[model samples]
Target chain A: DQQVKQNSPSLSVQEGRISILNCDYTNSMFDYFLWYKKYPAEGPTFLISISSIKDKNEDGRFTVFLNKSAKHLSLHIVPSQPGDSAVYFCAASLDSWGKLQFGAGTQVVVTP
Target chain B: DVKVTQSSRYLVKRTGEKVFLECVQDMDHENMFWYRQDPGLGLRLIYFSYDVKMKEKGDIPEGYSVSREKKERFSLILESASTNQTSMYLCASSSVGFGTSGRNEQFFGPGTRLTVL
Candidate 1:
């Protein structure tokens, strides 16, 4: 059973616009949520993360919002640039062990 | 910078052949993991080791085993390669341990694309 899921497979956005990617998970034990970006033929790189104790966390153009009651999280990239085009994955973890559960990635395209 | 290196970037093997994928980390992390990424399935953990000579099976452990002989190395073994096992394999290491917060991000290798014929 897949505990983490990304309903959208792809998203296209205009440059400098806001791009939102959504994720849902069934596991309530997950407390740490993260977003990773992957380019073709490259490993996934950590983008941003949010803890269950907070509803939102931000870093530069990337921000992650977590809603524990709804078991949902969304990553938002404002002023999205062409360089943001890549596969985005949402991951969750239960504890401090660093083991993670990942969702099907959403491919984001930032068009000029 | 923390570095995680994989033994291969690409490998092609015949079905039923034994396969070995090795990973080495330079940061002396206490935890290492092996994961397979498939289209529309994301990344699935196969196995992980928290200490040398110790390992724990992840969600998908069937047909796979792991070894941790040294603190910085982890090996994933496929007893018999199968077509279904062809996928991009990733290795990651993190420095999360006792007395430290688990907020550490896992550093990943470039990944090895394994093709089982």
Candidate 2:
């Protein structure tokens, strides 16, 4: 069973526009959510994260909104840049012990 | 910066061969994990270690074994390689502190793509 799901396989947006990626989870035990961005042939880099207690967390141009009631979360990048083009993965964990469950990634393309 | 390194960037091996993939972390992290990435499947965990000489099986640990004799190294072993096992392998490490909620970001290595012929 897929505890976390990223239904959209790919997304495209214009540079200087906004890009939104969505994720859903079936497990209620997950209290932490994170987003990672990966480039070709490289490991994923951390982007943003949100706790279950908070509805939203922002880091510069990246913002993560969490809705515990809906069991969903989203990563929004405003004024997306060409450098933001990469695969984005949504992940969740039950506690702080380091075991994370990851969703199928979404390929984001920012066009000039 | 937290750095994770894998033994190989790409490898080709014949079926039934014993394959060993090595990973090392310079961050002295308490947690290390191994995962396999396949098209449309994303990353599937194979095993993880929270401390030296301790290991736990993850979602997909079948046909795989792991060793963590020292704190800095984690190894994945394939007793008998199979074509289906061909995939990109990733190693990640994280430090989990008390009351941290396990949200500590994991640093991953540039994956190893293994092809079983």
Compare the candidates by DockQ and give the number of the best one. 1
Off by over 4 Å in 1: B97-102
Query: Could you list the iRMS of every candidate?
Result: 1.8, 2.0
Worst 10 residues of 1 chain A by lDDT: A42-51
Cα miss at A28, model 2 (Å)? 0.7
DockQ scores of all models, one per candidate: 0.71, 0.63
Q: Write the per-residue lDDT of candidate 2 for residues B3-108, one digit (tens) a residue.
A: 8999999999999999999999999899999999887778889999999999999999999999999999999999999999999999999887733433788889
Candidates' chain B TM-scores in the order shown: 0.95, 0.95
Q: In lDDT terms, how accurate is model 2?
A: 0.92
